[model samples]
Target: MSTITVDLNSKVVPAAQKIWIVHPGRNRSHIDTFESAGVVFLEFPALALRPEIIADDSLLRQRIRYSTAVKANKGFVRDDGTPIHIADYPTAADTDVSVHLRTVKHLTTRMMAGDLVIVPGRGAGGAVLFGEVAGSFFPQKSIRAAGLPFADTPVREVNWLTKRSKLELPAHLVKFFEKPPAIAEVGRDRWSEGFFDFAYDAYSTDARSWVSLDAPQYDGSDILSLVPPAELLALAVSLYRAMEQRADLTGLDYDQIIARFYDHDALAEAQMRFQSPGRYNLKDKDAKLAKWINGFVALALAGALSACSNGDHIEFTNKQAPNDPANAELTAMINMAGQSAGGAVLTKAETQAQHAQSKLGMSAPATVR
Candidate 1:
């Protein structure tokens, strides 16, 4: 296979952007209940007023009056507006009006514009939903206007990007979210970072081409486009796997490695491409390894190019076997490009020396012979 030359000018988007993982509902009733409604439900049952009562202004005022009266009487009011002693309710603490109000405020304030909210499947089986926060917090009254059922509750309007689409999370990733958080800020760490790109590509769109090198036209030549989103993410996965296998490769942490290779633009592009219909087949181990090497080369080249333009030394550490055939070729290409471009390149030995020097300053007791 011919080595695919990616255009360095191609815009890449970072995947490190903020992501909010939210459970659709607290329980089964809240989960998968919005499938037909085409909405993601976020329930706050603490706000104990029925939708119909909240919908009617007059009735809503009366309910508030009844609630105030019950609170003064140190009692409870059933959904029918019938006053009853607080001791009659099993989960009376959860029905505290103040507690409910605080929860609503907290959720609304934390969620902001441009945040991507991921709703994982309810129970063991349900479709995951990805929605962009189109609007800020509003009462369920506003949500009812959008034809949603919930009322007298607080809700943040979302423009559901994936409607009725089911996404199957990889086993590893599923385990990552096994302990569901009421709200999880994802993509900020290395382990959870790749998920956004994966999710976006799997359910986002049908277009396979990410960045086209050739002009837009019907040409007899094969169109040169950047690697498919799935492949790109797979390449990252491979690289991460390699790093995990070889501890001597680089001194940088996972986040640092991502910062150096997968810049903001590259990450953004990967996230956007996730919506494409193309899938990365993992069955072909050899082919996947080749792609992984190509991805490494691409990232190395990007680092070299940046160094060349900025007049800085580019460093890369290769801990693969000295006889590894692919390693020699990749090292040669990187060196040649860096030299031809008048950029300084650091060898593996040099990188090791630097690592040693940094460690030398550490305050460790002398080894007892």
Candidate 2:
């Protein structure tokens, strides 16, 4: 791993022209070490969460409260003007469904990928989400064929094989409450994987290629020029549900998964759930971990705002495994911002936040499992 170091000194590169240097990885020779201006270089890693696939169609139907089939129904005019009817939503029959979920996300004063935003509840239907939402939540589905033996190819090949796809129009319209042939694309570029990029096409003349990308569905090499409205809604709902579900998964299993990805001091406590270790109950462990993460987010936000200002430059370099208990990416971003423009815009919002926090008991909201 290469370390990233930023020289804030005015001599090396004027504070106004500070350069963030990163020693490129062996395989990443093309990546630059510095940027010249506005929003120069960015890298948002793709996240492929293993969602608890709700394949049980019956359960899904029950979750959505689908009783009447509504093959054909009639309605009467209301007192004022509108028409009212007790009819089943056409999407109730769809094998896939996406429900809009509203919740609060916890973000630090610094910018980081995969920051755990708090959603309100837990369990099935605690926070209803859609099918596209589920797919987008854990969008990174590994292509098994590419990873199999005999292919000592390259990471680029593996990367290329990891393209993302979406559902067709008719099915999407029924599910996401949108018209047929809608544009649906969101987040970052799946090809290179940066930030989420979503575009809409409910009002496009050409419904075929609403999103501007090379389309394989059509012939050889026709670039996307239009995006369908339904497709866009499906993409949005899928992303929303994926995020909501991810926030709700806080358990021994989740902790174990986190430990597998990055080691933490809490690993021993998490591992005890499997063996006859001590009287370490998984529930308490889960609560403590959740509380820990919550506090870390609070502290990081507070610290980052205290350090940075606008127009300041910060560099994030990997060092010794990922450590910054609060989440390395987050901490690095906070540190970077702190070294620059006297904290971010949130510093100004602190007063309003304090008022809200005081009204709400000042205790950080607990994440639902």
Best by lDDT: 1
User: Global lDDT of each model?
Assistant: 0.38, 0.22
TM-score per model over all chains: 0.39, 0.17
lDDT string, candidate 1, 150-268, tens digits: 23334566666553233445565555445444556665553454454443321111112122111122222332232232233343443334433432324544334334444232222
Instruction: Please list the residue runs of candidate 2 whose C-alpha ends up more than 4 Å from where it truly belongs after superposition.
Output: 1-297, 300-304, 308-326, 344-346, 365-369
- Model 2 lDDT per residue over 1-369, tens place: 222232111101011211111111222222222111101111111111122312433343332222111111111334455543333233244523332100000001111222211111122222211111111222233221211222111111100101112221123222322222111222222121111111110001110111111112222132231122112222222222223234322232322323333323322222111111111111111212322323222332233223333433333221321222323343344444333213332353343334323332222221111
lDDT of 2: 0.22
* Model 1 residue 55 lDDT score: 52
For TM-score, the strongest prediction is: 1
